[model samples]
Every structure is written in C-alpha cells, then in structure tokens.
Target: MAVEGGMKCVKFLVFFFNFIFWVCGVALIAIGIYVQVALGKALVVSGGSSAGTPVAILVLGVIIFFISFFGCCGAWKESYCMVTTFAVLLSIIFLVEIAAAIAGYVFKDKVRSVLKEGLQEAMNKYEEDPTLTEALDELQRKFKCCGANNYTDWANIKQFQANDTVPRSCCRINTTTCNVHPSPETVYEEGCQESIEAWMKKNILIVAAVALGIAFFEILGIIFACCLMRGIRSGYEVM
Candidate 1:
C-alpha cells in the first residue's frame, strides 16, 4: 500500500511539473519576442552576430510548449511509452540549453569589436543612408553617447568633415550651437560603445538568472518524468 501511494504521488508530481513547464514555455516565448525586438532595433545601428540567440530561444520555447502538452498527457494516462518519449525529448532540450549558454559566454567577449566596426561603418555612410542616419541618431540619443569612441570620432565622418559638426544627437544639450560648434561642454564625452556594453552587461545578468531558474525547473521535471516512467512500467497502478 505504501509503494502504491508513492507511485500515485509521483504521478501527480509529474503532472504538476508538466504544468510548470508549460508556464515556463510561455514565459520563454514572451521573453524571446521582447529580446528579439530590442535586438532588432539595436542591430540597425550596431550590426552583430548575436541575432541568432533570440530566434533560437523562440523556437525552443515553441518546442517546449508543445512537448509539455505531450508530457502532461503521458503523465495523466500513465503510459510508459509516452512517458519515456517525453523524458528523451526533455533530455535533448536540456543539453541544447547548456550548449546555448556556453555559446553566449563565448560570444560575450567579441561584442566590443563588433560594435566598434558597425558604428564606424554607420557613421561613414550616415549622410548617404537615411535609415542608418536615423538609427544612429536614435542609438546616440538612447545611450546618451556621441560616437564610436568619443565625440572626436564624428569629426572623421566624410559628410561632416567640411563643417566639423557632429549630429544633434551627440549634443549633451540640444541647442543649435551644440551641433554647429560642438565642444567638451556642449557634447557628450562618452562613447556609444562603452554605454552600450554597460547596458548589455546589466541586461545579460537578468537573462542569465532567468535561464538558470528555468534550467533548475527543467531538471526537476526530467527527474519526475523518469520516476513516473518507471512507476508506469512496473505496473504500479499509478492511474
């Protein structure tokens, strides 16, 4: 009777964990979409290779969303075959998440150079491309930064070389004189690259926390699923 009771508890625990996984899937999807949009905007001014991460996250979330349903049905029906399949799929996802975490860590170091190159390219073509001009202006305004390295960096822009003027977005105070006659007191001294890097570090920590928390729950779900799979196979009458 005690063993039967334990199996019954495992059955419900698997169901409960599957529900949690479903909720997590929804959360991941929401986060993925938010990050994807944010990155899309930023990449307009500072193109980089990190665009794949959010898309991968979105795809993984969709997969998890569907797989959780499968797991829920397996648990409720006490089907050994279905439960085993769920366990296998969950394990694969767990491995993929770990690999993604490692890849993110590796890519973190290259962001600075990527941002510098992209910003420089955007600046050189700022006058030629209205889209780049608008995006770069928004980036500068948002970051409260002037140029790739500093305000002086804008002096090298081909279109601005004649007048030696920077964009109004580089002004610390948006006065007419600030752009026409930029000086240390009138323009932002800080570089966009530094400001953007700081912003990314701050947000990456939040992403890391969410990823770790989800990973913990995923581990729990896998363990419970395995337990339930064994119970079902052993003819413990989990139903």
Candidate 2:
C-alpha cells in the first residue's frame, strides 16, 4: 500500500511538471515567431549572414514542444520505454540550449556590426521595397533615430542624388507635413546602430532569464520521471 501510494504521488508530480513544460514550449514558440518575423527579417534583408538569434530560438522551441509531448504521455501512462525516451530527449535538448546560450553570449559584441551593416543595406533599398521601407520607417520612428551613422549617411546612397532629402523616417516628429530636407538642425541627429545594439542587449538578458527559469523546471521534470519509472519497475518486481 505504501509503495502504491508513493507511485501515485510520483505520477501526479511528473504529469504536473510535464504539463507546465509543454505550455512553456508553446510560449517559447510564440515569442520566437514574434522575434523572427518582427525583428529578424529586417536584419536578414539588410545583409546579415544569418537570420539572427530568433531563428535558433524558434527551432529549439519546436524541438522542445515535440519532446515535451513524449514526457506528458509517458508520465500519464507510466510507460518505461516512453519515459526513458523522454529523459534522453530532454538531456539532448538541455545540452543544445546550453550551447546556444553560450554562443549567443560569446558573439554578443559582433551583434552590433551585423545589425549596422544590415540597416545600411536596407536604407539603400528602402524606396524599392515597400516592406523594407515600412520596417525601417517604423524602426527609426520608434527609436527616434536616423541612418546607420547619422542623417548624412542617407546622402551617400547610390540611388539618391548628392542633395536628395532623407526619408521622412529621420524626422524628429513624423507627420504628413514633416520636412525630410537635409537640414542638420531639423531632424533626429541620433544614429540607429546604438539604439539597436542597446535593444539587443536588453532582449538577450531577458531571454537568458527565461531560459534559466525553464531549465530549472526541466530539471525537476527529469527527476520526477526517473523516480516514477523506478517505482513502476519495483511494483512489477513485487508482483
């Protein structure tokens, strides 16, 4: 009776942990998609070598979602094979996430260069691609920034003449009436690279915090799953 009671407790704990794990996987996927589409695509179009950090997170989230199902079903059914598979898969994912986190931190300094180059590339074709145009406009407006270096950087674009005005995105206040004329005193003198770098740094810290929290929960899940599997084996041996 005591063994049966212990097994029941183990099952409940494993199920509960897996359920939360599954939900977190889903949340990660959602956030990953948002980051990739909203933030990554812009940089990719600009000349970034990779689709950026969001793509990695998206892939990890997908893998986690599938593996979490194994854990959920295994715990619910008390299946040894499924539970073992879940543990192995979890271990692999844990290692991959750790590696990815480390890589992101190590390469952090290069991130600004990538973003700067990409933003510059986008500025050249901003008029040609409506999507790029809107994205750049939104970025500049939101950050209250101008070109990669400053307002005059727009003057160097081959597509524009020596004296062509910058995009209205560089304006201190964007409106239909806002002047995009090349006037140093009228527009936002701040550059976008600094703002983008700052934003990336803040987001990196946030993602790290979230990853650490999920990792803590996953450790608990692995422990409960192993315990439940042992209990199941013991019960069978007794019978």
Per-model root-mean-square deviation over C-alphas: 1.9, 3.0
lDDT of each: 0.83, 0.75
Clashes of each: 0, 0
Deviation of model 1 at 88, angstroms: 1.6
Per-residue lDDT of 145 in model 2: 77
lDDT of 2 by residue, 1-239 (tens): 77777778878887788877887788788888877765654565445355655666677788888888888788777788899888888877778878877887798767666777778878888789887788788878777778888877888886555547777878766465454565666677888887766676778777777888889888888888888778776654211
Q: Residue-wise lDDT of candidate 1 within 3-84, one digit each (tens)?
A: 8899889888888888888888988898889877765645776664555657777888899899999998998888889999
TM-score per model over all chains: 0.91, 0.83
Instruction: Give me the candidate number with maximum TM-score.
Output: 1
Q: Give the residue spans of candidate 2 off by over 4 A.
A: 37-41, 46-52, 125-134, 159-161, 174-185, 235-239
Candidate No. with top lDDT: 1
